[model samples]
Target: MDNISARENRQARLKRMLAPTSAVFIGGASMIPAVDNCRARGFQGPIYVVNPRRSELAGIPCVPNIASLPEVPEVAFIAVPRENVVGVVGELSAIGVAGAICNSAGFSEMRGGEQAQRDLVAAAGEMPVIGPNCPGVANFADRSVFMMDFFGEHDQNGSVALISNGGSYLSDLGSSDRSLPVAYSVGLGNQAMITAADVLDVVLDDERIRAVNIYFESIRNSAALSAAALKAARKGIPVIAIKGGRTTAGQRATQSHTASLAGDDTVASALFKRLGFVQVSTHTEALETLKMLVHAPKVKGRRTAYATSSGTYAVLGSDIAEANGLDLQPPSAEAAAEIEKHLPPFVHAANPLDIVSSADDGKKTLDIYRAFLSGNLDVAVNVMCYPPEGGWDPTTWDTNTTMFAQAARERGLPAAFVNTMPEMISRSVRERMIAEGLVPLQGLEDGLRAVSNAIRSSELAEIVARKSDEEILLPLYSANVTNPIALDEASAKAELANVGISVPRSVVVKPDQATSFEDLTFPVVVKALSADLSHKSELGAVALSLGTSDEAWRAVCSMAENLKKTAPEIAVSDFLVEEMVKDGVGELLVGIRRVDGIGLALTIGIGGTQAELLRDTATILLPASRDTIAEALRSLKLYQMLDGWRGRRKGDVEAAVDTIQKFSQFAISNGERFVEAEINPVIVRPQGKGVVAVDAVMRLAR
Candidate 1:
């Protein structure tokens, strides 16, 4: 087909698949819920059940085969056993069906099922297939439901679109008693034809979707989804994600669950952060984050205030806020005076604006909220908790919630509520708060963390949206090798220096030609250069702090002898003598390593002998902006030391950032040539002085 016609055909096919007028279900009693779901969705289109053993199912006429169908259905739900799924799909495709939702198991996820899954894909050429082993698909806008089981009563026009790889979460999110407004949801089992990225692309095109919730075991087509997500983020639609397989056991489970190949999680996290996705760790976090994005205004700053009746809540809230990077600033004296008007004389008016717990009425809570909203703060949080024995009064709570939500909206401020106890708040009350545009958070710690995450995501989205042409990624090295080859220290340092990075002045000479010392400083370091030996220090091939010419010469002779006697297999073609660097404030490790799916990951961390014990590192996606580099450095635990901890002089962080940028460019340009490149003990000096790389290594791909 030509370009225009092909595009048109795809568009039409997608329309039919998303809003199919008629659908076929190919199974027996297992498809009862699907039929009920179809009825509940108000799908007035024809429903054909193709079961050889049954004459009719759930009042729908059952046909013997695809050939016996009265008309070509727009879509088919294949629920047959795995062994027969490919043949059934082929038959349906021949009948000109637009797409199929293969809700069968035992495909590629199981042993000996790979070929069968391949056959199923081959059979459905040019037709969109949801999954060969999945929970199925649901479209609220068009009422196109195709699942073997029902979660709960769903709205016909929900706003949140969820796409996941796991079925249980899909069902859980769909059936949520909390009434999460999910419009479109699908579990892309196996993702043979339609991947998560493809589904994300389609869902993003829907104007009704205000947010996207995705839970993935792994990302197969990261680049495509990244672009799609970035587009959504720019349009102010948040993409919230929960990535499984972060731990070793979880990784193994994920591979078995969906035939997914989980890669380095740090790289994946960097990718998500770079693309402006709000990554969460749990279903609750994802839902809460989405709620904030959908309803709350953009957070202007971190300054926050809380209104609560209990003094203990004030303390708890303060701790949680500080832990999550939220600043619970004390109210200004003027603001405190304003709050004093509502509270009793014994109640101290502070940031958490402690209201007397013994107070009988909600006046103090409401007045404190008013004061918080009017004060010089970016956001407000209200803690509303009541014991069951305190006599549950719905009227007072309802009035208080409504007033709080209304005041926030009228004042153009973002506010959320923390129900200390999940069971304390009634379902109807929570729903009402949500409807009134107030984010009602349950569970104290979870609520606080959620609020902080929401604020940070908003800030990050704004930053990403404002970014322009601030990054340029160089081309990958054009090498066709298969194995990695280690480069000698001299060669590695030379490569780094060529990329505009500073290195210690060094001279390489054969064992017999080393009649030097006039051209070099007295106190120098000597090392035997050999690609075969990665750790020269361990092999006694290193000589440090030689104070004299004779001392350096004798060290080189001793290293050669040690190598020849102790480790004869190691080849030493030359030796390097380099001037020692002592004026250093700190040592750092800077390097690049390939991350599967994503490209090379540029990493920086605390270095020297403590590197292994501290294990403080930060990985950033390559070709990052200077601001990103600086932000990453600030995120490290060692930032305090680098920023002049304990009244010490600060390290030259700007110099380090510049060196990192240059290294990133070189790594990007030579991605295919090397598997890894690193400089250990990159001596960081005082501010204004540049950093110097003292030791280096490079591993080239064969």
Candidate 2:
């Protein structure tokens, strides 16, 4: 498949196969909600409900089967028994339905039915399906509702959109029953048929849908979703995602709730962070992120002014803002001075504009708020929790809050109203806040988190979309034959060294070989050279700091003997002897992964096995520039060590990052053909000295 042919094929698929589909065929007796939902949503398209026996439903005509459909249904939803689903999908495909939603049970999530699940997968080639056990879908922009709950009167804000696998969970937030701007949503149960990426592919064209809510149980085509997410971010449209599971219990709930195969959630978190999503946990919070997506004004650059009523809120917000890698700073002097006229003596006119909640005068409230929103301030924060009013007219608190809010809206700046009671904030208040284009957050923490995430996603998207240079994508090559696989340390380094990465000097000796010929001196580390020994050190397959040659020989002999005892199948190539890296300030773990929902993600964290347990890691999009790299590293909890902790000399942070950055680019370049690559303990020596990779592991995509 050449590029031209592929492009032509895709173009044909778009024109001949996919169009703004109207009237989807609903298949299943259990899909009563989907059928009822379609009618309530005022679906302009025709309905062809498919069931074994049903004459009429929701006042729409029903068909006995797919063959009776009046015309080639644009979309077909198969919600029959698992055994019958594949066959029904075949009929829908034969009749020319472009897309299908499979709500059948007994797929991958089914217990002890691996063969049945595999058979179900085989039937997916006929048409795209959402789930084998999904509740259904909803498209607010097109007025198509396939889920039971989203039919309630929703806000037509037109800026933000949501997609979720747990439709009812999110709909509970919609139960605020307040009008909102919703584009579409879907509860993709198993995603065995129609995928999240496929839905994005269909809806990305909706200009009315400025943002997207990507709800998922598992990420299948992460590359496609990443591209779409990046696209949305570049366009200043936000994607708020509520991945179904992150805990063992959550993963189990995902399996039982909607019948999905949930994997490691850390991967999902990193992916969402990279691919431009405001990741939330519950369905309610998922919608909360829409505040930032729809209300906040897009910045021309990364510059931002952070304002808060409380100094503490401002400080925490600033910390969070910077941590997620934002430029939250005090408002400019001119901006502060403008607000000073209204500030009380107790409330200093600071960047945070801490207008001490003690003030009761309406004029003071309006004056300070107006100054912050006077276009001079880029964004402002208001800590609203009904501050102690001394029992003044309870309505007085309401009046003051409303007046202050109105002033901010009157101006062009984006302001966030943070309530201390996160879950307690009324839905009506939230809807009112959104109507005025105000970002309302549950607490000070939530507010800062949402804004910071949006800013990072927006900035990274801009950077990636505009990128078109060599630096944007680095080159990598292995010195040894890559097909057979490069196992030796020297071979791995030769390949990495080409791209400017550093590797420890080493001498390789064959298994059972003597230390006499080993060129590397004493106090060296010995590692068994076998692909199977990926985590060599973990299984005592590696020895470090062998001060004596006898110890080095014994370690090598021990590793070889161990491998033979464990599994004679693993062919031992050679034993690696290299100086044990000890001069580095601290160990750093660098890795590149193609995330399930997002594309190329580069992760940097504290080294050793506890890395995953601590989750003390930072994630960023691949091909990041040096400036962004520095910013991301600076946000780490280990940044103090990197910055010369406890009088120890600072490591060559720039050089170490350069190597990690290069590795990330390499992984991205090989993304089409590789699954993931990791290099642990990229030891960074003192300043002026470079870093070296002690070991690495690369997993090829099967």
Candidate 3:
């Protein structure tokens, strides 16, 4: 089916799942709290309590079983034992129930339960089954609660929807004091039928939801999830996520909690970045960031202006902004003059104008902010500190910040409030800031980072939107190779030369046939070439700078004898004789690695022996355009050196870019024939000189 049809189907399923007019509670015990939460949250529909032993629950009439229900409920919450869950869910689906939340455990998460989980999913059919071991689902907007507990009586329905794999964390965040406006909260236990991606699509279809926050341990269907997230990102709906497993210990923990395979951390990070989702680490950061995005979110550029009531804060704010990638450039002469009118004589009129404490009543402070904002700054910040001790009157502070926010919103300028001491800012004051559409930031550094991230999210969202419709083709391996086989350097170099990439003048000669090298240039390299050996250098199988035929012959003979002593198990079949490449300004390592879920990632880094130690590399996901190649290269630390550091002559960066592009194409075309490929020390020469692949390696997939 096309995307629109799939989206519509999900939307229809979600409508029944989240805002069901009627529900049935299938199991006894701890499910009472779920039913009570639903009622308390204003679910006035007919609730059928199904229990074989009890005739009633909480003064409500109960049925004996699924077959005894008066009618099929639009939604059902199944808390039966593990063995009975699949049967109950199948019955629900047969009865034409639209959705069900299975809260039972021991499916896929327990040993030997994988098939059980698969059966549970198959039984649900097209109906969305939340989990077989999850906390349940809820929609605060419509007051259809089906979770273990609900404490959102104080919450106002807002834009952000949170979906989590671990039920406990979702409960904690749902009950926090941060006052985050939640539209829907779901605990995706095993994600049997509906995954994080499926839920994301459902929420994105709703105009009421402006953002989504996901806490997932594992991704079952990544392509669907990525497509949904990219779709949301293109529409300016920020999708923020905090993946659980990013380390070995953490991966094990996640696996124990929810039978999830937390793929490579590096690969996951690259995937998040490529899809334009803001990846956060801590819960505090996630809450604050969601709040910020819910408030004044979009900004066009990094240029920012701030007004502080204290001198120390002014200096600190400037440093914080600079560190966060914000430009605190001096305003135009006219704009500077306008700002000076409101500033006290002692305070210099600058990017971060320090309005003295004498103007604490907030009129002059507001005016200073207004002046900078009027000058077309992309973002404006108001720094407020030192709340009155016992005399902490919050009304005046609230009014002042609210007015400032209004002015900024009217002008379409992103605004933020920096509470230097978070403890000093009262909840009322924070609420006022949020209500007025201004980001309430806590600490100077944290606040600046939040603002910077907000701006970056907008930039990345634009990038996602720009490329949303473009299809990314992943590398598929060939089925002919049963086991991986490493290609000798001669064959690898020959393949490289066929793809418009330059390689050294080379020839393959056996030990018995190596008589004359007069046809080749001087200063040659001779090394053993064997498909069985991959790391030839480590085995003393390589010799460089053989300037004559006699030297080349002697080097090959010595290499053969050395290989015999070190590795008697292997045979030195032949030697590759090549002209030694020289005069390169820099060396680079370019390779392709297949990442789980995300596909091929082309890595380019500083080359030679220290390449692994330095790890100074950047990656470009496959199906990369020329622009992405250049951008990834420029992001590397090696790029500075390549671009003529310390007054050195500029290297052929453009030529390097061309080489990378051609190499990527070659990898894509021949990727199916091999499992992995690399070109080490692709010699980069001075300007106008082309690069050469000095050494290369390719291995067919096993």
Clashes of 2: 13
Worst 10 residues of 3 by lDDT: 253-262
lDDT of 3 by residue, 411-519 (tens): 7888888877645666676787777788787766667777777787888887776773443223333233446667777888888889889998877777677467777
- Which 10-residue span in candidate 2 carries the lowest summed lDDT? 253-262
* lDDT digits (tens) for residues 1-702 of candidate 1: 885675457556766777889999999888888888888877879889999999899888899999999999998988898878888998988889998888899988899989998999899877778888888888877788887777556767688888988788888777866546778878898887777777777777888888898898876766556667666776777788789876442232210111111226766777777777777888876766666666567776788877776778888878888898888877878878877787777876787766554244566656666776777777777776844645766566566667678767766778887888755776677778877778787767777777787788788788777775233222233322466677888998999999999998878877777466687866899999887765566789889889988888888877888899878987786899999987889888876766444566677788764664676778777778889888888888988887899998899999999998998888777757756677877899999998999888787676
**Using TM-score as the measure, what is the rank order of every candidate, best first?**
3, 1, 2
Output the lDDT of residue 199, model 1.
Answer: 79
The C-alpha stretches of model 2 lying farther than 4 A from their native spots are 1-29, 51-54, 58-62, 112-126, 148-151, 155-157, 247-266, 299-365, 371-376, 385-398, 409-411, 419-458, 469-515, 518-680, 683-702
TM-score of each: 0.86, 0.73, 0.86
How much lDDT does candidate 3 score?
A: 0.76
Candidates sorted by lDDT, descending order?
A: 1, 3, 2
- Clashing residue pairs in candidate 1 are 481-702, 482-702, 483-702
Full-model lDDT for every candidate: 0.76, 0.62, 0.76
lDDT per residue for candidate 2 within 1-702, as digits (tens), equals: 785665344334332222335655555445677677676766766677766577875566787777877788666666666668668766766666666666566767768756665666676454555666766666655566666444355534455555556556546654543334665655667766556765665566667766677777767765556556655655556667777665552332210111111224665765565565667765545554566656667633444555444577667666766675556555556767877767656666655556657346777677766666664445555665643335334454454556566786686656666775565555666666666666667755656666665665566556556654322332232221223233344555566777778787677887655547356656888887765565565566788778977788788888788878776776886887887777787777776654434445567776665555555677765666777677777777977787788997898888877887788767656646654556776887888888888877665543
